[model samples]
Every structure is written in structure tokens, then in C-alpha cells.
Target: MSAVAESTAAFSAAASRELGEGTNDTPAIAALRSEAVALSSKKAWPDSRKERPWKYHNIATLDLGRYTPGMSASNGAAAGVRSCPVTGEHAAAIVLENSDVIFSEASPDGLDLIAFSALIDGRLQKLVDERLGSAVAAGTSKLTALHYAFLAGGVLVATAPNSEFKEPVRIVRNYSGGGQFAAPHTLIVTGANSRVHVVEECRSDEGDIVVMPAVEVLPGPGSVVRHTVVHRWGTNTKVYTEQRMVSERDSEFVSLQIVAGGGVVKGHLESSLVARGSSSELYGVTLGTGNQHADFFTTQDHVGPDTRSDLLFKSALRGHARSVYYGMTRVGLGARNADANQENRNLLLSDTARADSDPVLEILTSDVIRVSHGATAGPVDEEQLYYLQTRGIPYEAAEALLVRAFAGQVLDRVADEALRDELSAVLDARWDSPE
Candidate 1:
């Protein structure tokens, strides 16, 4: 039997026990158990059921006993690595490693950096606690249930009312001790009219395998939250992320995700604009070399009048790598003058590399201004390559340069020049020739 089959059976059994008894019995969770079992054994297409390349990536294989109930030592280590990519500043922060709250701090005034436990004691804790389970409950999936069972600590960030943080608050998370599973919890609440930028970086330590399950962001009225996530995990890790952003009236949310790590990563990202004049911008770029894999799904929900949203995602896969994206836009009733757009484009570098792009839109009312989604997947442009090659550049160099230019379009859109440059370098490294 293939590794997925063998691992799936084991994973299903462990997951069933959690889901079966979780939340006083969750039928939906039970359904996932049943689906997982069949998924392990079933094949969508006959004669070709490729074994998942990284059998060691699963997070459940870790020794749960090693992680104590509170923030572990690694939390401090993660905090120590806290950095500001934009302004080149350092921060007083907390860290979570291997789903364990390995390091924590309670330094007030500079920037509200508190662990989840402390936030629970603070005034704003209720907002996070209340909504925590509303969207991604334990019953939603077995993986999250496992996270619930193993989680020890979480990062709690609060942007004080109209408080403009000069240097961005950074919540840095890392993964070490492979063969370990981690459920990381983090929540950010911005006070009204406040503006703050955040950098959430995820890295992994050297080990056999790892699993990461995470969740939500809350941006309030008139608040502007610019959030960036850097995923540079060990090549032997598998990560599952579930995140959502809800924007209130006159608020703005900007999100950027980079997936240059992980052997197998799957997740969903969504934004819901619930008030008038609120806006959201979502962008992502994924790089997969060798047989690495990354899968992402995003949704833009325009529920209020005059809400605007724009989303763009680009992926470049080489070697035997693969990347897939599914995006959707939903316009609700009474959402007048709502404007939204989503676009997905992919570049496949090798014959074995693969990508799937799908974009969809759902409209509930006819009075809306506009909404549309588009997706495209293809290899390098022959014409562009031929033209460059004819100009005296070698075929390899020409292709490389063109490929960089294709991915550059997304980088140029980033507000942070440093970040844009960093992403550009990663892209060039992933593709031997940018063309």
C-alpha cells in the first residue's frame, strides 16, 4: 500500500477518537473521519494514485509529552527572532513553536504584546474568545480538533485605540523538533481608527516532520491592518492553515502570504466585508521546487454597501512540484456599489510540474456595481522566449529573465520594497532560469 494509505488509516483512527467524543459528540467531525478513511483508500482516477511525496511531514507524529502545558522555552527563542522587515526594527514579542507556546512576554505600552492566556484576563479577550470557535470550531475538522487537544499557548495582539505603531508588531512562529505536531493560535484586535502593521513569520527547525494548524484576524472600524505571513518551513513539514478576516465599517485590511516552504501545505483564507466603505486587499505568491506542494483557497464576501476588494495570487512551480488555487467572490443583498475583482495566474516550469486555477463569483442582488473573477494556467510564453533568445541572450538566461519578469508583476504591487525584493530573490532561486 502507498504511504498515504498507510498514514491515512492511522490518521483517521486518531482523528475519529478526537472528533467522535469532541464537543459532546460532533456529527460533522464524525463525517470527516469517515471521509478521511475512504480518501486514504479511494482514488479519483484509476491507474495513477501517486503517493504523497513527504510521508514525514505530518505534525501528529510528534511526542506530545515533551511539550508542557504553558509557553515552552522556544517561545522566547521565537520572540528573540522578532524583526521588522519594513523599518528594520526589533520588537518585544512572543513565540510559538511546534504548536507549543514555547516563549511569552507581557511588556505593556510599547506595543500590546500579550499571550492568549494574559489576553483572556485583559478586557479585549472576550472578543477573541467569543469569535474563536464561531468560524473554525473543533467540529469543523479533525485536524483542528487535534490542535485543540494539543495546544498549550497562543499569541494575543491588540492595537490600542487610534494608536499608530511606528514599528510593526511581529508575531514570529517557528517549527522545530520534527515528528512533532503543533496547533498554533493567534488573534489580533485593532481598536477603532487605529492603524498598525504586523509581520507573522513561520519557520521550522531541523527534524523529521511537522504539522501546523492555525486561525483568524479581526480588523475593526476605521482601522487599517496590514498583515504579512512568511512561510519558510522545513522541506519535510506539512502545514494546515485556516484563517479569516472580518472588516467593520470604514476599515481596511491588507494581507500578503508567501509560501516558499513546506513539503505539503493546504489551507483556506477568507475576508468578509460587513460594513459600508470597508475595503480589503489580498495577495499571495507560492514557490514549489522539487516535489513540494502548496494548495490555497480564498473567498471575498461583500456583505455591506460600497465595499471594495481586490485579490491577486501568483504561483510558480518547477521540477516535479505542484500548486493549486481556488478563489471565489460573493456579493450579498443590499450591497450597493460593491466592487471586487480576483485574478489567478500560474507558470509551470517543468513537464512534471502542475497547477490548477479556478475562480468563481456569486451575486445575490442585481443592483451591485460589479464583481468578477478570472484564472489562467499555462507554461512560459514561447514568443517572449524566442524574442529574448534572438536578441543574443542564451536560451537559459532568456527564459530565466522572462520568468522573473512574469513573477515581478506581483512583487511590484507590494507596498514594501524590501519585502518585494526578498520575494523576487526567492522566486529566482526556485527557478534556475526566470524564463
Candidate 2:
């Protein structure tokens, strides 16, 4: 067998040994895991030379055989991880450490927050069974297949029809220990006419760890769903994240990703407007320092008539950091009157810092209202820095201010003031001390 296949087999064997140890695994779940392992065995690892999305990152250097699947954390093992609320007030909150739930608050009425492992025995079993893997399938990529094969702890968030959650639902995940692989998944299903917001935060202790996190959102007709994820992994952690959303007729979906930590991070964020009148808004912010690397691929797919989407991603790099962004806005042949826009901006703070950005648009229909994209990467404007310095601000301080303002453009678009403030604070903290 090839090296990739051998690694897959070894990891699969390790996963199988601890497969249903601490959680309920129904036959369906077991079958899904087995199928994922089988699919992984046939897939080759991504080659940077051959794949556009993998071009900036060297995936061959990562040895999957060196890391074993993480098990559930023992009681009190999460003492160092706190479950503080990011948005001040929340309808529900769950704290996960090493892919194990250590603390969880009761969900509000009309909202069901159940562990993915408990789905088979819970009241929302049927709903989860139908929608669990609908938005992001395991066969989407080789890494995704591995994610499902060793899937350990996950959560399912389901909303009742016509319900509204004034407060956001929060999830905080913390990872520690060395040479371990962690997979955390979240499946969200919204009912028709429902409105909800979800906030997820990720942190890890200083260690060599691999994390594959996936989130899939399915918005029902006329529903409004918002999601935000913050990455604050340790400097030694390698992270790969996948998040996708599918909007139904007249539904709206909004998502934001904040990447500030990790040794090397790569991921895909995608939104599909599958029904008429559906809309989506996507935003991302990345702050890289040290030798950190962050790479992302995003897609805005308009598959139905009168669908709309807008995306903005920004990155600030310092030290020897690097950032890469590839985005595509596609209007299907049947998507009449579709409107889409995409933008990516990068700021290089140091001479050695690097940024690569590509924005593409593909429109099949001539009846589209609008389709546009823009991308830019460069160093801090000397004129702006001089202006700030002339006002008695130190050069370094002025540069920092400019960088914050550059990233603040996207943060200003957040709908919730409280959440926006919290994220702004996080940005400042990460910028001031990016170690």
C-alpha cells in the first residue's frame, strides 16, 4: 500500500479499538463510521503541487500514523478549561475538552441541544438521522472522510418551527495532550420561520495535536440562522476545519470565522443557496504571527432563482506568518436574478510576512442581477503610517492601529452589538500578544 493508505489503515485500526467506548453508537452510526474508514482508505492525501486549494500548505509533512484518536476526557480532567460565556448571556452553553462534554447548560424552550452520540436515543433521533450528514458529506474530501471515521464527540442543535432565540447558543471546545487526533462535529437544523444564533470558541493547551472540526447547518424555509467560530488553538496545534450551510426557500444564513492561533490551519467555508429567495453572508478574519500559517477556501453557490450572497475575508500577518485565501462565487444555470459579491483583503506587517488571495466568479445565466469579486494584498500604506506618526503616534502603534482598522471593517458588519464587542476584544488581545 502507498504511504497515505498505510497511514489511513493504521489510524482506522486505532479508531476501531476505541470506537463506542464512552458514548452510545447505534448501528447506523457504526455503519457510517465503517463506510468512512473504507472511503478514506481509497483516497490519497492532498498534494500541494496538484491541488489548487492545497497549494499553499504541505499536507505530506503531516503524519497521521503518529497521532492516535483522542478518547473522552476523564472527570475533572477539564479543570483548566472554563466554560465562560462569550456573549454575556446565552440560551445554552456546552463545554467540551478533548472531544468530551464536561459542562452543559440546559437549553431553552423550543431549542434542543443534544450530544450527537445521544441522538439515537433522544427525542430528535429521526431529525438528526435525516440531516446529520446532509450539508457536509464524509465523501467531500480525504480529510473529511478521516474526520467522520474517528468522529468522537459532537452536538446537534435543532430548533422548533416559528421559534426565536433572543440569546445566542454558545459552545466552547478545549483540547490538550500530545500526539492525539481530535474530531469535533456540530450539526444544526433550523425549523421554518425560526431565528437563532450560535457562537463557538476553540482553544488548546501548548502541545502537538491535530484537530479536525466540522459544522453543517441546514436552514429551513424562511428561517434565519447565524453562526460564528473563533479559533485560538495553541502554537503547536494543527487544525483543519470545515463548515457548510444550505439555505432553503426564503431562508437566510450568516457566518463568520475568526482565526488567530494554530501552527498551521487549513479549512473550507461554503454556503449553498438551494432555494428561491434564499440569502447568505459570510465573513472571516485572520491574525497570524510567529511562523503561523492559515489557508482557507470558500464557495458561495447560488443554485436557485433570486438567491443572494456576499462574502468578505481579511487577514493580518506579522513576523514570518503567511495567509492564503481562495474564494469562488458561482451562479448556476437556473439561478435567475442571482446577486453575489466576494472580497478578500490582506495586510502584511513584516517584510517576511506573506499573503496570497484569489477571488473568482462564475455566472452561467445572463439574467443575473450582479456578480462581482475583488482581492488585494500588500504592506501597510506608508502614507497612512506617516499620517498617524505625524499625529505623535509611535510607528509601531500606528501600524497596529491601521491593522485593526483594516480588520474592523468586517467586524463592524456583525449584527449583534454584544457579540461584536466581544470579538473586537478578542481581536485586540490576539493582536497585542500573538505568541
What digit string (tens of lDDT, one per residue) describes model 1 on residues 227-298? 778787777777777777888899999888877777877777888888899998988888778778887778
Best by lDDT: 2
lDDT of 2 by residue, 153-208 (tens): 78888899999998889888888887788888888899999999988889987889
Q: What ranges in model 2 sit over 4 Å off?
A: 1-10, 78-87
Give the CA lDDT, 0 to 100, for residue 389 in model 1.
83
| Global CA lDDT computed for model 1 | 0.67
Candidate 1 similarity to native, TM-score: 0.77
Give residue 368's error in model 2 in angstroms.
Answer: 0.9
- Model 2 gets an lDDT of 0.85
Q: In model 2, where is the ten-residue run with the lowest total lDDT?
A: 78-87
